[model samples]
Target: MNVSVELTFTPLQNEYEPPISAFIKRVRASGFTVLENPLSTQVYGDYDGVMHMLTKEIKNSLSNIDIGLFQMKIVKTDRSSYVADF
Candidate 1:
């Protein structure tokens, strides 16, 4: 099944821009259709593929910073219905 998700990464550090940028880059590199906004990134793709990519990349992001927060809102639906404004 296909899925959609909104992801937010918050790094608990004084200098957080680099890590956040890197994490967004990783998400883009995963090949999923990503709509990046100021507060969150919306990803659209196959459920399994999305989950696997997120699990690996999120872990990688955390490893780099050691302390961060990952937030996600997922829905088992198509992009048009679940994600607003495409």
Candidate 2:
């Protein structure tokens, strides 16, 4: 099954932009279709692949920074059906 996720990363530091930017870049580089917004980033792809990549990247990001928050809302559906185009 495919999946879609709305993810938000918050770094608990004075300088937060770099970590957030790096996280989004890693998500994009993972090959999932990424739709970035002001609040959260939406990712779409196969369930296993998306979850696996997200887990790995989030872990890597947190390990490097050591202080941050990761939030997500996941659904077992395609992006087209889950959310309408703008």
* Candidate 1, run of 10 with poorest lDDT: 77-86
Stretches off by above 4 angstroms in model 2 are 80-86
> Residue by residue across 57-82, what tens digits does model 1's lDDT show?
99989999968998999988767444
Indicate the residue-level lDDT of 44 in model 1. 93
Per-residue lDDT tens digits for candidate 2, residues 28-75, read 898888888899999998999999999999898898785889999998
- Give residue 60's error in model 1 in angstroms: 0.2
What residue runs in model 1 are displaced by over 4 Å at the alpha carbon? 80-86
Pairs of colliding residues, candidate 2: none
For all candidates in order, the CA lDDT equals 0.89, 0.88
Best by lDDT: 1
